[model samples]
Target chain A: MVSGALLFQSLILGLLLGGLYALLAAGLTLYFGIMRVVMLAHAAFIILSAYLAWWFSSVTGLDPMISLVGSVPLFYGIGYLLHRYLLSRLRPTTMTMMSVLLTFGIALAIEGLLGLVWTGTQRRINLPYGPTSISFLGAQIPVVQIISFGLAALSLGVLYLIMKRTQFGRSLRATIQHGQAAQLVGIDTTKVAGMGFGLGLATAAIGGAALSLQATIYPSLHWHWIGPLMAIIVVGGLGSIPGAAIAALALGTIRVLLEIPMGPTWAQTIFYVALFLTLMLRPQGFFGGRLAQRF
Target chain B: MPNDSEVRTAVAPPGSTAVARLRSLGSGRTGPLVGIVVVIAVLATWPLLAANPYMLSAGVIVLNFAVFATAWNLMGGLTGYVSLGHIAFFGLGSYGTGLAVIHLGINSFVAVLLAAIVVGLISLLVGWAALRVRGASFVIVTIAIVLVLLLVFQSWRSVTGGSSGLVVPRPFPDMLRPEHHRVFFYIFLGLLALVLVSYLVVDRSRLGQALKAIREDEDKAQSLGIPTALLKLAAFGISCFLTAIAGGVYALWFGDLDPIFQFDVVLSSQIALMALLGGVRYLFGPLVGAIIVGSALEYFLLNFGETQFHLVATGLLLVAVVLFAPDGVLALGAALIRRLGPSATSIREMSAADVRAQQDERAAARGAGAGGSVTEEPSERASDD
Candidate 1:
C-alpha cells in the first residue's frame, strides 16, 4: 500500500527534519563525550538563537542565514564563558544534576527576556522562498526545508572534518578518552573544555536557525524543544555524533509516517511512546553497542 | 605513600559487619528528629504571626512546592535517579482526581487518596523499567513518559477535554468565601506538616542510610547484598505518592486544571530548582530553598515581571551554589546552628572520614602518576565508602 513517491516524499521530509535535530543534538553529544556534562540549557540556546534571528529580521531586515553568522559566535562565547567560569567549578558527581537546574534557570531567564521584548506571541522567520515549493518524484518539498537541511548537513560535515583532522580535535578526543592523561600531556584541559562547549553552542545556533524556518518560534518554544532534543541525544547514545544523526533520522521518519496515518495529535503521543520504549529497552542505544567508559 | 594515605585508601569490604553497623547508626532517628520538630512547629504557627491573606496564600503555595520538592529529592537526590518528567506523576494525580470528581462523583478525600495510589503504582511500574538505565538514559525515559502524558491529555478530548483542559467543581464549594482564607490556610499548613513528618520518618529510619549508600555507590551497596532495585522502587513509589498528593491538593486549591499547566516541563524544573537551591543533601533543603527563591520571586522581583529576572536569578543562583555552596541553603542554616550550639563531636567525626578520603585520593593520584595504572579495588573502593 506504500507508494514509492509517498515513501520518497516522507523520507525527504524526514531527512530534512532530521538535519535540524542532528544540528541541535550534535553539540550536546560532543559536550557529553568530552566533559561528561549534559548541558540541559542546550534547548534554551536553540530557542535563544531563534529569538536572535527573529529580532534581527524584524529590526534590521536581515535574513535568518545572515543572522546565523552573528548569533553562532555570540552563543559560542556565552557557552565558553559559562563552562569556564561556572560549570567547571562543580563536583563531577553533582555536575549533571546542577547543570539541569542551572540551565533551566538560564532558559527561564531567556524566556522571560524574550517575553519582555517580543511578548508571548509566536513568530516565524519567513525566507523569501518560504511559500515556494518544488516538485520532486511526484511529491512537493518546501524550499526553506531543503535549504535548512543543506545548511545542517554542510555544517555537520565541516564539524566532522574539524574533529577528525584538527590538532584541537585530537586533543578533545584525548581528553574524552582520558582527561587525566590529556592533562598530563600539557593539554590545557580547561581551555579545551571551554572550546568544546563553545563548539556545542555554535551548533545550537544552527539548530535554532533551522527550527525557525519550519516551526513557529516563541519564548516558550524551549519547553517544546528540550524533550525532543534530550530524546534524540539519549536515544542516539550519550556522546556519539553519528548516533545522534541516526536517531534523529529514525525519529523524524517515524514522526512523519505516524502523522500521515494517525493524525498530528496522535502522532505526537506515538513519537514519545516510541522514545519511551527505546529508552526502557535499550539504554545504551541501538548503535551504542558495547558500553564504553566515559571520561 | 604515607600510612595515613594507605589507611584512607583501605577499601572496607561491602558485606563486612563493620559497614552494616555504620549504616544502622547513620540511619538512626536521633539526628534529624529535633530539627524536624522545630521546623514543623514553626510552620504550624507561621500564619498566626503573619495573619495576612496574601502572605498565607503565598505560604500555601510555597508549602505545596516544598512537599513536591521533598518528594522529588528522595528519588533524585537520595537515589541518584534524575527524573526531569516528574510532572507526569503530578499530572496523573491532577487528572485522576479531577476526572473522578467530574465523572464518577467521587468525594474529594477519596479521590485524592486514590489519585496518590494510582500515581504511585504507575511510578513503580515506570521506575522498574526506567531505573534499569543509568545516567542520561534515565532522564530521557522520564521525559518521554511526561511527553506521552502531555500529548495524551491534549489529544484525548473525550476524557481530558483536549488542550483547553478539564475544570473540576471546587471540592468544598462552600469554602470559597473570601472570609474562609483561614480555613484553606490551615488545610495547607496541615498538609505541609503531614509531608514533613512522613519525610522525616523515612529519612531517619534505616532505609535512609541504605538509600544514601546506593546513591553514593550503587555497586558497592549491591556487592553488599543490598536489594538496590527494590529499595529504589520503594523510594520512587514513596516520592510519587507524595508528589501526587501535592498535585491533588493543588488541583483542589486551584479549582481549575489544564493539561498544559499541570504537565508543563517548567513546573518540574521548578521543583528541581527548589530542591537544589535549598540543599539537596539536607532534609529541609527544599523547604529552605523554596521559601527563599519563592519569596524573592514574589516580593523583590515583582517589578521586573516584564524581564527575565526569575530565570536569571535561578540560573545565577544554581551556578553560584554549585560552584561555591552545592550543599544549599540548608547547609548555611546548619552552619549557623553549629556555630551557636556547643561543640559537637559529630562534626569532627564526619570531617575525619572526609579528610582520610581526600588524602587517599591524593596518594592514589601520585601512584597513578608513577605507574600509569591504578587498582580498581583502591580507587573504586574509596569511591564506594
Candidate 2:
C-alpha cells in the first residue's frame, strides 16, 4: 500500500502540473474552436516565449514573470498578423491540410531560429524561490510550482471571464457554434477570428513564463510538450475550454500515478497511449457532443 | 467546347487508321517513359564516371530519401491523409532488420524482407484502428503512435539496445572493400527503382483512382460505394512496406541504428515535406525534391557543422511552396513551358480536355455507385464555402 503522505504529495503535484497543462492547451483549443485549424506551432510559440522570458531575465536581471509585459503583446501581434494575412486566405475545404503544413513549417522555422540564437542547451529560470517549499498536511510542496499553478489558474480565470462576459466573447462563441449564423448576426467573424487567434497566442506568454519555473527549457523541448498538450485538448474534447482544463488535470494526475509504478521514461507514454485509446474509443472526446462528425 | 474537327477525332469512326496512329503518337505515356530511361541511364553510369566513395555514399543517401519520400507520398499525397508519424515504420524496419541479423543470424536480404512483412502486418493493424478517425484526429493519432514507439524502443534495452543503439552485422562481411559503397549504392538504386515502378503501375490502376476519389472528398467517395477504409488501409500498408524496405537498406548501409535518429519526428516531417515540395501529384516529384533537399542538407551539415539553418531554409521553402505552388515546382515548370511554347492555346485546350476527362471519369464512377446525387452537394458546398 502507498503511504498517505506520498499519495497526497503526488496528488498536489499532479494538480499543479495539470493546471499548467490546461494553460498550454487552452490556446490550442481556442485556435481550433475559432479557426478550425490545428496550430501545430502552438508548442513552438510557447518555447519561443520561454526563450524570450529567459533572455529578458538574464539581460535585465529581473524575474521572468516581468518579461511577460513585452512577450504577451509581441506574440499577440504575431498571431494577429498570421491569421489576418496568411491563414485567413486559405480555402476552408483545404484549410485543415494546409494549416497543418503551414504551422509545421512555422514551427521548424522557429525551432531553427531559437537554435541559432541560444543554441540547443537546456536552460531553466533560477529564481530565488525555486527551491523554497512549504509543508502542508505533512507534505512539502515547492513554492515555484505553487506560484506557477496560481498563475495558470489566474490566467484561465481571466480567460473564462473574457470568453463569457464580453461582447467579443459572445461573438467568438457564436462563430464557433455556427459561422454562417454568426455572420448573419453581424459578428464580423473574420475580425473575431483574428482577435481570437491573438488571444490564444497572448496566453502563451504567461504559460511559457510559468513553464520556465516548472521545467527545463530548450529549443526542442516543444517536441516533448506537443504530445501532452495534444492529449489534453483531444481528451478534453476539442474546442471545449472547460473540458480541456479538466482533462488536463485528470491526465496530469494519471501521468504522475503512472510514474510511480512505471518509472519516469514510461510515464511520458501515458498520455500518448491515452490519446490513442481515446481516439479509438470516442473520437468525439469526453465532452465533445454534436461536434463529433462520423468518420 | 470541342470544335467539329475535335469532335470527329474524338468520335473516331470505325477503321480510322490515320487518326488512331496519330493518337498513339500523342499518348502521354511516351514522354514519361523517355524521361525515366534518361534518368536511369545517368544514374547507372554515375559510379563508373565518378568512382569515389564519398559520391557513391551520397548517392546512396539521396536515393534512400527518394524512396522514403515516394513511399510517403503513396499515402499522404494520393489519399490526403497526412501521416506525420510514418517514421514509426522506418524505425521499426531498422530495428527489425538489426535485431534479426544480430540475434537470428539471418542474411541482410532476408532480414530486410522479414522486416517489410512484419511492418506491413503492423501497419495493417495500425491502419484498422487509426484510419477510422478522419483529418486532424488521424494526424494526431499518427503522431502519438510514433511517440509511443520511440519511448518503447528507447526503454526496451534488451531488444533495441535502448538509447545506446544497436549495430548490425554487415550484409557482406567477406566483401568489405572500397567498392562496397558502389555495391550498396547500386542496391539502394535498385530499391528506389522498385518503389518508383510500383508507383507508376499503381498510378494507372483502379487503386490509384480510388485513392484520388478519397482525397477529393472522402465522404462523397464513401457515398459512392468506394470502400474508402479498405483502400486507405491498402495504401497505408503498401506505403509502410516500401518505406520499411528503404529503412532496412538504410540499416545495413548506415551500419548502426539509434532510436533517436531512427524514430525522429524530424525525419518523418522531412519525408513529407520533400514529397510536398517536389509535387505530390507528379510521379517524379519526390525524387526531384529529395535530390535537392537531401543534397542541400548534406552540404549545410558539412559546412556549418550541424546548425539548424538548413531547417529554416526548408521551412521557408515549404511555406512558399504551399502558398504559391501547391501543385509543386514541376507543375510550375510545366506551366511555364506551356506559356512559352508556340502552340500555347492548343496546349491549354489539351490540358482542359484532360481535366474534363478526369471529371467525366469521376462522374461515371459516382453514377455507378450509391447515393449519386449526394456527391454533388459536397462538391458544391466545398466551392461555395
| Candidate with the greatest lDDT versus the true structure | 2
Model 1: per-residue Cα lDDT over B1-385, one tens digit each:
1322332223233455976657654765334545665776788776787656777777777777888888888887787777778888988898898888887788986898998998999999998888777666666667778777887888889998987778877867776544455566667666665666666656645677788898788889999988988998998899998889888878877777888888877677777777877888877888887887778767755566645556566666656666667777778778988877756667776887787678678867877787746545465665577
lDDT of each: 0.76, 0.84
Model 1 C-alpha lDDT per residue in residues A29-145, reported as the tens digit of each score: 887887767677788888888788777887888777789879888988988998887778777876665665566567777777777777878898766878998998788999888
Candidate 1 collision pairs: none
RMSD of 2: 10.4
Model 2 accuracy (lDDT, Cα): 0.84
lDDT of 2 at B207: 93
Candidate 1: segments with Cα more than 4 A from true spot: A1-7, A289-295, B1-37, B49-52, B300-308, B336-385
lDDT (tens digit, per residue) of candidate 2 on B249-355: 89998889889899888778888888888899998999998988888888888788889797687777777777777777888889898788878989778986786
Q: What is the DockQ of candidate 1?
A: 0.38
Alpha-carbon error at A222 in model 1, in Å?
1.6
Give the clashing residue pairs of candidate 2, or none.
none
lDDT of 2 at B217: 89
